[model samples]
Target: MSFLLRLTSRLTGRQVGTDRFGNVYFESRRLQPIYNRPRRWAIYARGGREPTVVPPEWHAWLHHTVAEPLPEQKRYPWQQEHRPNLTGTPESYRPAGHDYVGGTRRVTGGDYEAWTPGA
Candidate 1:
């Protein structure tokens, strides 16, 4: 976050909550004249500037979909914990045939023939 933003937030923002990722949520103490509602925003945790790091519950709150963040609800046993996007990182997923994996795809028996334009 920039120093100007930090200063603005501190001056006009009222902290609403903090998420598990350490992100802090806030709302403008004074309502916006155009919208007649307090503006909402977040201070992303270190290394979490990617918007996807904001969990679903917090996302809804940030967008004004709800008056307040929904209470934490139980997750299904099959549900997995949230993780930040890992694209471009070493931990990102790579298919078996990707160059980083082995650049060569295993060939299976022919399943069909290529189609001709008019045949």
Candidate 2:
């Protein structure tokens, strides 16, 4: 965390809860003059600050989408565990022919040609 964020967090934040991943959630103890509502925020448990690190339940609460945070036991058996988004990371999904994976796409035999404007 930067000096400013650390300072701001200390000055205005109150711990609301922590998620299973160790991400700590907070809300402003009092509304500040700059905003219409008290602010809510989170500090990432992992070194990276990926938003995906937050579970679905916490995501809803953080955005005020739900009135209350999800209870630990409320999750259904069919539901999968939460995982952070990994679009650009090494762990991200890559199709079979992706360049980064050292795979080459099969070339199709020439069956058509591009049309020239005046041809």
Candidate 3:
């Protein structure tokens, strides 16, 4: 966080709520002149700067999609739990033929022949 944000948040921000990840959400005390709506923002949790760390309800509130944060509901058994993005991390998924797993890809028999120029 920068000094300007800290100062602005202190002066103009109101505590809205914190997400399960510990990210703090705030809304401006006064509505912004241009949008005519209070500005909303979030202070990410430590090591939780990745945007995907935010749950769907919190994300909606931050974007002003809803007047208030949605209440939590019981998840269905078939529903998958939320997870942060892991594209560049070791925990990310790798296909069977990927270089990191193994360079060789298994060959399957095929009837198609390679094309040649005019032959």
Candidate 4:
């Protein structure tokens, strides 16, 4: 976070809510002429500011897709916990046969064989 952003957020932002991960959500105190509506933002709790860290409910709220924030009582038994995207990280998933996994895909014998032209 830069000094200017911190100052702007402190002066114009109002704390709206905090997520389970401790990330703080905020909205502009008043509508801005540039946006014509109160802008929303979130400060990441973790060292890296990964957008995926924001849960689906908060994400929807931040993008104005929902009028109200997620309610605690609305959660269901099947709702899965949020997990940060690990696409390019060391902890990312690699299925079997992946070089990183040190596994080779098994080649099963089949009836079909490659045919060369004029062979």
For model 3, residues 4-98, the per-residue Cα lDDT tens digits are 87678878998889887788888999989999999888877755357888899888888988999998779999988778888999999998889
Residue 100 lDDT, candidate 2, scale 0-100: 90
* Window of ten residues with lowest summed lDDT in model 1: 45-54
Question: What's the TM for model 2?
Answer: 0.76
Regions of candidate 3 where Cα sits further than 4 Å from its true position: 2-4
What's the residue-level lDDT of 13 in candidate 4?
95
Off by over 4 Å in 4: 74-77
Cα lDDT, model 3, residue 102: 85
Which is the leading candidate under TM-score?
A: 3
Model 4, range 1-119, lDDT digits (tens) per residue?
Answer: 56676678788898889888888888988887976888899888874568999988799999988877876546678987779998999999999888999879867789878999999
State the C-alpha lDDT per candidate: 0.88, 0.82, 0.84, 0.84
Q: What would the per-residue lDDT of candidate 1 be over residues 16-112, giving only the tens digit for each residue?
A: 9988889888999999999899999999987536888888889999999999987767889998888888899999999988999989988867887
RMSD of 1: 2.5
Please give the clash total of every predicted structure, in order: 0, 1, 0, 0
- Pick the winner on lDDT between candidates 1 and 2: 1
